[model samples]
Target chain A: MTGVATLIRQPWLWAWVGALVVWLATAVFTGGKGSGEVLSAAMTFGAFFVIVALGQMFVITLGPGNVDLSIPACMTLAGTVAMKSMDGASAMIPVGLLLALVIGAGVGTLNYSLIRLLRIPPIIATLSSSFIFQSAAIWWNRGLRVKPPEALADFTTAKIAGVPVIALFVVVLAILGHVLLTRTIYGRGVVAIGQNMRAAHLAGVKVERIRAATYIMCATLAGLCGYLLAAFSGGAALNMGEEYLLSSIAVVVIGGTSVAGGFANVPGLWGASLFLFLLVTMLNTFGAGAGVRLVLTGLIIIGVIVAASGGKART
Target chain B: MSGRLSPRLLRSLLPPLSLAALLIAIFWLQPRTMSYFGLNLLLNLAIPIALATIAQMFILCVNELDLSIGGFVSLVACITATWLHDTPLLGIAALAGLIAAYAALGALIHLRNLPSIVVTLGMSFVWLGLAVLVLPTPGGNAPEYIRTLMTLKPAYIPFPIIASVVIALVVHVGLMRSAHGTVLRGAGGNPRSLECAGWSLLKIKMGMFALAGFFGVLSGMALVGLTTSADANIALRYTLLSIAGVILGGGEFVGGRVSPIGAVIGAITLALAGSFLSFLRLNPDWQIGAQGAILIIVLALRVLIGRAEARK
Candidate 1:
């Protein structure tokens, strides 16, 4: 009983509760019809969100004022470049994937240089860089949508035992992410820097190197997500990554990660991602208009953030 | 001490210097822009941008960012073009309500210690939703009075210049010179001190948010007046533009340091950057990239100057 009580108090538990509650709400609303379908759909889409949010979580965990506003543009550029490189050729998939990762690394390097060398704030640096990336995407393909290769698309959309393959892959990835956050020196360094940069540096945490690695890791994951998302959706559009910007941040905050930095919640990422998808799915199922749906999303997000952050008192 | 003061002075001078340089380059490239008519053509759209920058500056002074400013401006524009044009009283009430809502949001954020970015991100959705609900298709008439006011040509100078000058002076006087403004800014610079000094942080935050809302309304109304119409997504870009404008004008993200006059100038400089690109005949596809490059170059210049300062 005590163990269960402690589990209930964990910050990550609320997101799971919220996800389950919304899922049940949707199930109840439809008289249990299509509930399985809704859950499957949530799993499929939620995987993409979890991928990006994972990167974002690491970035946010580094400290306040540290966020990657360029995720959307990076995704667009990567997806566009990768799709164009593959060009419906299964044989060129590895080359395209490598190219996407390279683009992500380059973007991350530029973003970090702007922050470190130019001494610009991270928010402004990433935001400005996004414009360049977005324009690059536009200039490269002129906003054209290119279809993914046959085998890649099939693998992305394929399911095993009613579970999406991508979702399963991401679940294993999340387990690895959990181990990386809690059981690694670099992870501890990130948390240390977030808690107190000066102390972290004094303790020989290699603050700059750790920060650099975290950012590069984040962008690399964003790259992989873009590649898979393009494949899953059958094509890559210019505006494909636009909605992920908000959703990525929303998932992090809603998952009960401390916005102030120094803390992380890996399990909560999955729950929050599913909850967000289901919330939208619930609204859509009820035949709510766009305006109403958006308003409710805003209000509900506010509610969740409030509830999640309620326990901790900050001066 | 004198050497340190020189660097501070130099930092203060960068915004105006850059604006002048850009202006001179544009005039030299397109000599016709030197005339009053050409100047109006170049700067007419800058009025709303300057207002939005000022709104952003107000929030920056309180050490908060308003990601919803773009959406808020879009909603205001929709209301101005639709209700304000057709039903004047109803429009006034709606605008007032929006400003009140902004103040309420500030109180909620301050009391709960919620991250402003998340709250405002959510509010951005709400504002966009409301704007879409109000103007589904983006066709509305600007109020007759607003249209006339926007287009009024004064003697000896263009209206945009006059309006921008008045705006800068008014905000400068209100926020930079007034005693109350100091207290408001102090809330951001050192809230604990202000709390110890027995000032209500909540009221200060509310005032700042309300001021931001007021300027956002002006930006939206001015934009609609100039364009003679409104759309749900009309000012979606203003959020970023305003932040860039504030930074260009030497506003720091966390500090309470901000310059109203410089912010307006920075806004004009950015607006002129678009014109400069067109004059240069840059490819339309690369214009956005060029804008980003310009932002990076300017900030890089700031860093170079700082390095010099540090060496000294």
Candidate 2:
């Protein structure tokens, strides 16, 4: 628990180092400027996961076993609903965006009500809401693919200073998330509530409101991520949000955020997201198929959980 | 005496009673469903789901969650359609080993104090990977005998209904009315006390997980039997469906409280509810929403009733 040891114990550092190692290996393999493009591509794809993971990290920080299973559903809803509301018009982007966030907030409110009012477990409550939102997305689909407005599409693909604007947004969001969790009262309240809800409640923290906010934050970010993903892809597919569900959770876990809750690892999540995407690229570099890659992802998650064990929740 | 209508009593009765009411309502709306054959066809899918829910209930009884059930069932279906149909001994041995692996998972969860959710989530992928490797696609035939058994029809009763009844009865007796099951539940309710009383929480918890794996296998085989075919991705939805069934059946997250009969009843209710939605001019696509809406309403009612009782 010494300062140096604590620094060494930071798992996100290792994730980044692993990512660097992969990049170096790719450099060694390709032997040229290809690695840079690969790196940027990884970051660009990693941006989506990073955005989703930031929200997941907040919910994870809310307490042990707390997760927003409805994230993908929320994202799906936002993307499809936004498209429907926008009616394919480029000028209606802002309105569509607002509607998407509002839908996210609505799902968040449902989840909060289920957990708070009915005392349902966060996992189950969010999971139930995931079903609701998933169906809502399906109903909205109605034989239509969500075509994001032209401006939104341009914005998603637009580059500034040779860097993807979305990547910068992810970085800024990560910084804001880190600051919110570590440098702000509300953020501290979240950590406290996750650590020990009753204790935090007794300590005069607005435990309920903080928990509600984190879930809302998680869903809202998921909404934005969905919107961006739709715009980036130029249309929404039914399964577009499927990949985010486990990876976001995986990123938080890999980032060394304790699943037992009360711990926030926003910076670690950013690194972990980058690391995961890099790992995918590394696998692809080796000609690994999707099946093999999926297997490895599962194995790596299990390995990380086993390796990080400090006898959490044994009591 | 409040007519002895304690909220605890009503809460315990509500899930299955709601299911009964649902059945009656469905029948009232579509009277054709009241017949045994009609009910059988409607609830054919409920058999495996109920088994999985029963499996999930065992795990939840120990205050742990298994996100791997869906994957496990799909893997089982793959095995049933492929290896079990082709090579009985090897497939049977593999299944027993899988059950043992589940017990090992419980031991690991206890020994390492790992969160069951993450472990099971990770295990789910492994299971899915193995499943994809086995089937590689969605085409395999269930053994003829298995299909025959699944499709068995009695003159007066349906196969699924009878099977569900037995499942509910056996598990109810085993879990709710038996001493060993009480000890197992105690591991969740008061592990410290159970340990102090010289019972090994590790043993009970592992036993619970083993039972889950056992039921999970049964569900997988049942699903394959009902479908008469198997695919790599089949049964993936069972994970959430089973969890929903358990919760809808009066199960709690941390408490050791879970009802076996109610889980089966809940499963049937969910299946019927989905069918009812599609039957009532609702789009098949919107059945999921209908399920969610029903679940939330039931859970909210349970909460309100609990709060009222507290006030009393």
lDDT of 2 by residue, A1-315 (tens): 599898887767766766787778777766755787787777788889998898898899888769999998899889888888887898899998898889888888888888998898898789888988899899888868867888888877777776788888889988888899889989999889888999999999998888888888889999988888988997877678987988888888888887778876777776777778887787788777766776776777787778777666565
**Candidate 1 local lDDT, B273-309, one digit each (tens):** 8888788887676666766777788888888888878
- Per-candidate clashes, comma-separated: 0, 0
Over all chains combined, what TM-score does candidate 2 have? 0.96
Q: Candidate 2 on B77-133: residue-level lDDT in tens?
A: 999999988999988998998899999999989988888888898888888888888
Candidate 1 error regions (>4 Å): A311-313, B1-5
lDDT of 1 at A20: 99
lDDT agreement of model 2 with the native: 0.86
